[model samples]
Target: MTTKRREACPNLEANLEACNCSYEPCGRKGLCCQCVAYHRRAGQLPACFFTEAAEQTYDRSFDRFIQTWS
Candidate 1:
């Protein structure tokens, strides 16, 4: 399957307000598609899947996400 380059999300500014990622220097902070794709490629979920406390740990693993919820 081919992936198309996505346009910047229309809600980027609003998304940033709600983004809980604790990583200060992330390039993909407000770019949800890029953030999701980046993490998916690594078999993980983006920091948004995690709680603010969990996100700070920067573990991004799918297992960690589940453990956080469970």
Candidate 2:
């Protein structure tokens, strides 16, 4: 079987420098699939989950994500 290639988000790729996701454990810094999977497994979104300032704080916790959205 052949392995499927992952797709990268052009928009995100162009804006990675501005992205604030601080969870370094993520393998997909600009890749949407890998990022989504990583967050899903951890029950959280990537650094892009919060504003630039908030993301800079490096708090990728589920509660923080909810607090931001709320």
Candidate 2's TM-score reads: 0.58
How does candidate 1 fare on TM-score? 0.83
**Candidate 2's residue-wise lDDT over 1-70, tens digit each?**
1122223454564555665666675556656667778778988767777887768777778898888888
> Model 2 clash pairs?
21-47
1-70 per-residue lDDT for model 1 (tens digits): 1122124566677778889998888878788888999999999998888898899999999889999999
lDDT values for all models: 0.83, 0.67
lDDT score of model 2?
Answer: 0.67
lDDT of 1 at 27: 74
Local error of candidate 2 at residue 67 (angstroms): 1.8
State the weakest 10-residue window (summed lDDT) of model 2: 1-10
